[model samples]
Target: MTSNSDTPASGFLPPRWFIRAAWKTHKALYRWSGGRFGLRTPRPDRYGLAYLTTVGRRSGVDRSVMIGYFEDGDGIVTMAMNGWGAPEPAWWLNLQAQPEATLDLAGGTTVPVVGRRAEGEERDRLWERWRELDDGLDGYAARRPTETAVVVLDPRTD
Candidate 1:
């Protein structure tokens, strides 16, 4: 897709179908190969892909999603924008009700973590980091009618 000086991401995100399929493929490859391939995407955007497991708020079952994330201190940070960009993702909603979760990095290492939204200076700092990773960050975010959320999966302490 062609981009202009005034527009980033070319003013559009990939079709939701492609995004979902790619995600499923990413997860499958990581799981099946055990990190032999499809470990991460380095170009266009950098995402230390991980599987995040969260307890469902209503279903009372575990829900998992393959998410793109970047390192933040001793934790990992990722956005909660649904692929099509509208109502927030189910994982984020579940995290809101129960912050405790586990993250499997590239299907190789599992880390128990507590998820929370970054706020104030911390939020800005994280957002800036995301901008560095993806020039289309704002363009993709603008598609959402509501503010996109940044969720930090801080290491869990037992």
Candidate 2:
């Protein structure tokens, strides 16, 4: 996907078929698990997968996306863009505008976190670690020349 300003708003909307398949898969799992168990399931392909919900910076509507996350010292970091081949995801842009957001984990815990963009060697190291966990990230990084970043989401203490 292209990384132009307008694309962030419209770029990541996957094909209709993909969305339907995702929804169907989610629904079937939820039904089979009786709702309670499904929410606790880990995303198969991503490491530390979690459901993140953030409000749109411009639209003011809540948006949610499932993403890969990793623990960085005391904070939680996400790849921000895995397969998108874009500069960044729309949700990440929203968090850039409004740092505070919510994350739902596999264990059913919901917590607020503050997002910050990682850079330089710190970002390189984190990306390397991510690659160690999932190799496909290397390919994802190659597709988009725009620098992929790590978003460190600090847990809200209060």
Candidate 3:
């Protein structure tokens, strides 16, 4: 099938349902294993996985989800993409509403952070970094109806 700047190639990635299920299973693995599984540190050319907890905008409750990220200086960077779907991820929306959050990394390390969107040159640089990690980054991003936000989670001292 032919693809354009607006339409991403389909066969490159699994269907949306499968992608969602995989993430659900990953979360389950983390929970069932008592946080022993489902997360890894970012290598020089690969992204890391972590569980992020954010406050719900309306419910006022804590919401947590697994996300992929890479360390940048003192902050962590991730994309607000919903499995490459058109809609923005709920976790990202929650972060926008309440930026203060918690990041649960591998080896039982938890870091408090404040989330914000990376803009201008920072966004371009971080987006390019992500492109290096995934060969199909641009293709997957094309599936989104809107531009994806590059989220920066900076460590919160207080």
What are the TM-scores, per candidate, against the unseen true structure? Answer: 0.85, 0.72, 0.93
Off by over 4 Å in 1: 1-9, 34-36, 41-45
Candidate 3 Cα misplacement greater than 4 A, ranges: 4-11
lDDT of 2: 0.70
Displacement of residue 68 (Cα, Å) in model 2 is 1.1
- Model 2: per-residue Cα lDDT over 1-158, one tens digit each: 54432332333345556855774576466446643444543343446656778889999998777666777777888866635544567888999999889987776588899889888888888788777776555554655778777888889877
For model 1, the local distance difference test gives: 0.83
* Poorest lDDT segment (10 consecutive residues) of candidate 1: 38-47
In candidate 3, what are the lDDT values of residues 8-93, reduced to their tens digit?
23326778999999999999999899999999999998899999999999999999899999999999999999898888899999
In order of listing, the candidates' clash counts read 0, 0, 0
Clashing pairs in 1: none
Listed per candidate, the RMSD to the true structure in angstroms reads 3.4, 7.4, 2.7
